[model samples]
Target: MNIRPSAAIRQNYNEIADMCRKTGEPVFLTKNGEGDLVVMDIGTYNRREKMLKLREELLAVEEDRMRGSKGYSVEEVTAMMRNAIREAEGHGTAE
Candidate 1:
C-alpha cells in the first residue's frame, strides 16, 4: 500500500493525484498515526466500485443458492434481461 501522511496531501496534492492516476492504485492517507482515507483517480474509483458491486451481487446469489433458492444460470439471466429490454422498447418477445 502506498501510504503518506495527511500533510503530504495538503502539501503535494497534485503529485499525489498524479501518482494515483499513473499507478491505478489507491494512496493511503494517514492522520495522527492512524489510517484515515484512500485516494484514487476517478476512473480507478469507478472501476473499483463496479467490481465491488458485482462481488456483492455474486455473494448474494451464492447465499441464495445455499438456501435452496432457485437461481437462474448466466444464460437464463441474459435471455431474461434481453427479453425485458425488448418488451420495454415495444418489441414483442422474440421467444
Candidate 2:
C-alpha cells in the first residue's frame, strides 16, 4: 500500500530503500498519476518469488489430485518422513 511518485526514486532513493528493507514490502511508483513500477529489497523479492513458485507447485499438485492422481496415505507418508529423518541423522534405517 506504499505509493510514491516515480521521481521519488531519483530524489529520495535512500529513504525508499530503507523503507523497503525495514518493511519487507514493495513501494508502488506512479508515473503521471498512473502505476509505473515497484521497488523492493532483494531479500523480500526473492522470498516473494519463492512463495509464488511454491504456490504454483501446490496448485499443480491439487490439479493432479483432482485428476485422480495417486497419493500416499497418512501412515505411508509418516513412515517415509521417519525414514528420511533417520537417514539424515545417520541413524541407519527406520524400522
Which predicted model would earn the best lDDT?
2
Superposition TM-score, candidate 2 onto the true structure: 0.78
Q: List, residue by residue over 1-95, the lDDT tens digit for candidate 1.
A: 79999999999999999999999999999999999999999999999999999999999989999999997889999999999999999998959
lDDT of 2 at 77: 99
**Candidate 1, 39: how far from true, in Å?**
1.4
The ten-residue window of minimal lDDT in model 1 covers: 86-95
Candidate 2 colliding pairs = none
lDDT of each: 0.95, 0.98
The lDDT, on a scale of 0 to 1, for candidate 1 is 0.95
In angstroms, give how far residue 67 of model 1 lies from its true place: 1.2
Please report how far candidate 1 places residue 70 from its true position, in Å. 1.6
